[model samples]
Target chain A: MIYKSLLPIIITLLITMAMLNYLISHVGNEEVKALEVENEYLLTINVFKQLNNTVPKIFQAKACLLISNPINYTCNVIASNITGIIMNALGIISNESSGVVRYEVVDYVIYGINNETIYYVTIKALTPMGDTTGIVGYTYPFNLCYYSQFIKELMNTLNANFTIDVENITVVQSSLGNEIINRVKSLIGTSSINITINIYYVGVFRMINRSINRTTYLGQVSYTARISPNNVHTCNEITTLAGAFYVTAVVNRYVNNTYYFSINGAININSMVINDKTR
Target chain B: MVVVDSLVFPDLVITMILIIIILLLIVYVTNQLIELSMIDYKASMGTYLFLKCQLGNFTIHLNHVIITNGTSSSNYLLICPQLVVNGSQIGAKVYTAYVKW
Candidate 1:
């Protein structure tokens, strides 16, 4: 009968439907895998965007201090501080730092190269695939030479060059100005707290070796500059580059898809190298 | 012979043709499904490529905005810290982004 013929057709239809379902499922799985890889890139870029400039350089400052002089803050202390920062930023990174990209922070390594430090952080995603990295930045090579030495040498030069005391310090004579000093000047706002020293490497050549190899005569290294107590915005009585600490505030605001990151930091007085015998 | 041709044989022929059509439809639909998947893959990849370009710009802008000052760019700004005696430091400062970061 006709019913007997319809049975064969029904069986064929069921088999075809099964095959199509399997094909769709397989293709979907492949697409999902590809999507995961894209997500990794998104997550990396997001983390990089979040870290910005000031954050890395601050850690580098600590690294510069630690490698240059270990007595001020223990490695453990700095490590804990780094952990605290990552933890504090967890909510921010998950919710706010990344607009749409998502990831987790696992750990960070304070890597030093060419007497400079950059942060290499491991960011984890909730994907089947694992962790990845985004970099932070560096302090200047000149700063690795130490702020005390820089200020002291400049002070000596200033003393020898002109008859101006700390009070009358203004407009470094264009003759006295060099590439390095001007480079330092532009990083900080006028009458700002914290000193930011940024040095872009020509070749991050992975070629590095650190030594305390510095030689300069520092006369009267000890000088005092006032620091405002309540949330140091300005170094009111700071002249002659003394007592000013490294404190950078990141006004990183994303408005209308325009990202803004600016740093206002201090030139850490604790890393002072006064005596010729010490440095 | 005429009865067989008119009823069972003709019916068998039509049924076979319908089965063939259904099988062809399945093949066409499967190919379309695959093509759709590929389009989605291409779109996602394109988005990531755009993001990668933005990252490059971000790197450039970060280097310029931090050390140097006073200039603008709608494209790649050179990255190097220097002291320019002539006028403004010889580099781009303001990076006018082409895409949302």
Candidate 2:
């Protein structure tokens, strides 16, 4: 009589368990797709946040170079190299999406009386659907003032103490020019391997009566600085020509074989006259 | 005959109705428990995916608990045991912590 009375309770318990299992399985199946969507959204947000934290730091460090010498070719080098290292680090951080998405350089815009070059640059990591995760923009300003100062120093050194003779000029070009270039490189902080500094003078010198013409000046003396850590061997030359009697100096700089910066220095070169007649 | 019909029949009918009510209550409670588990599983999985991406290499442990009125509570470990081999987690730097909730 007891067994018969408990039979209904036992049967009911078994049926309830079966129904619970079915319900759990059904819920699990329905949520799989929703879970996947949520997971992707969360991952994207995580990546974007990480990028926001890091990209600015890298940009700030590299952009600081521009503050010192805006037209320093090493600025470009350091920016790209550091950015590449950071990108590689980020790739290893998360294996979800690895590699550079896209980067754009807004051709160096020469602006202001100082002739500062402004690079409006932007880098982004995005998919084809325009879903951007990581992005950075920088309006990098570089003034040619630093380079102009060096040129002024070079001109002063050449005119003040050095005699206008082949031997003297050769010594001045090799020794004094090398010293200046080395100092500039050190000041710009591009202490990388495989740097080549080429300095030479260009123009016509009518050596009449062992005296330089009154209208004579170093037509175009160039400082071709090639500083490459990655062996790209790009030549950046700042060619400056002093005007008649040093009334003015016109400066033109070619970076990566493209003329980008120009400036005019207000200085008197009247003292550079070499009159062998006086000797 | 009058006493048998009034008292015994009424008792039998009441007992059947009580049994039906108990079964329905059981089904309702079971459904609610399963729904809670479903929510827990979804949240845990989402957390696991997020940590995996943000933290690089990490481990996750999710402990699920279920209790019923007449039975003892049961504990379940949702994720399987993942062995850390050769002290190398995909050759990545151990960023923060190994395992999280």
Candidate 3:
């Protein structure tokens, strides 16, 4: 009688264990799904990090080239090179089946090229969601702007160390020229590959537009200085009547945190002639 | 009548109580064993998954250790990590682990 009574309890225990096992496996399946989603996100994030790290290095190299040898590289050539490197990095990083990357140069600015050797450019890149084209099925939408931030920082650092006292202008053109030349000497003092300065008494005007606005300053000062890094020998000469404008503007529209700047200006170099000895 | 009342009925009641207690004990032990087995299963699966995936800065171990760089955590359960070996997909089982980056 005791054995007969125990049979039902044993059968129930077996059933309960079986059910619990099934429940545990079901839970595992759900957990696995969550894990897969997390992994996918991580994968994409890694690719983006790789791309971000690469961009600045390329820009820095290009900037160094531009600063060192200003005459050889125009802003156009530098911009094209930057664009190519960005696209190449994107291709290398996200070469997966459902990955695509594309970028465009929305705006750029070039200034003081023929006169003082300054170039500013910015490019905006877009990685849209879904495959707009069959070639690269878009994984996600990522908007990245590669600005001239690296170059800008370099210039800002250079400027801060040396201040130009523009508030006091001498009445005599010759005396005023002497004061300006001394200002350049104080700023350039024994450091830099080469130094060139063009001081302008140009009128300044601001033009506001929907996308980008630029300030145009038109004036002319004929000035050139040849300084030695040794600080042993320094000479600068100044002349007058050069028509040039310093154009500072935001020439590009910003989209999705990406900014485009178009930099355009014109100066008549013939009107302001620096003595070839100052070269 | 006195024997029935004092001895026989009392014996039957005691025996019934003993049987119920024994059944409860058995169920409790079975449940505990199941839980232990489940924990072991989870650990092994977690190890397998972690090793196979080769994710950055993630590891799985049964114990704890101090790390300097990134982040790490202990996982109790994991799907088997998938890997390609000899150009074929393979799944593996590993140990329960604490992962650190």
Candidate 3 lDDT tens digits, A150-200: 223323322322212221112223333444445444433333223233344
* Model 2: per-residue Cα lDDT over A1-279, one tens digit each: 333474587577768777776776776666654554443443344444544445444544444443333334344554455455444443443332222122222222222223232322233434322443334333323332334344344445434322232233223234444444444444334311222223333322221222332221242333232221112212233234332221111212111221222222222211112112122
Clashes counted in candidate 2 amount to 3
Give the Å shift of residue B2 in candidate 2. Answer: 36
Local error of candidate 2 at B27, Å? 16
List DockQ for all candidates.
Answer: 0.02, 0.07, 0.03
Residue-level lDDT of model 1, residues B1-101, one tens digit each, is 88866777666766777677667766766676665565455445435444543454423333212312322332211211111111211111221122221
Better candidate by lDDT, 2 or 3: 2
For candidate 3 chain B, the 10 contiguous residues with the lowest summed lDDT are B83-92
**What does the lDDT read for residue A75 in candidate 3?**
46
How do the residues A1-279 of candidate 1 rate in per-residue lDDT, one tens digit apiece? 334576576577668667766766776576656655554544455445544543554454444444333334444455456545554454343443222334566666643343333445565544235655555433333222233333344434323322111211122122123322333343221322233332211100111222233111111212232221122222222223332121111112212321222222123322112122133
lDDT of 3 at A148: 26
DockQ, prediction 3: 0.03
Indicate the residue-level lDDT of B17 in model 1.
72
**Candidate 3, residues B1-101: lDDT per residue as tens digits?**
89768766655675687567658857765775666565555545554554444543344444432222211223323222111111111111221223322
Using DockQ as the yardstick, the better of models 2 and 3 is 2
Order the candidates by TM-score, highest first: 2, 1, 3
Estimate TM-scores for all models: 0.35, 0.36, 0.32
What order do you get sorting by DockQ, best first? Answer: 2, 3, 1
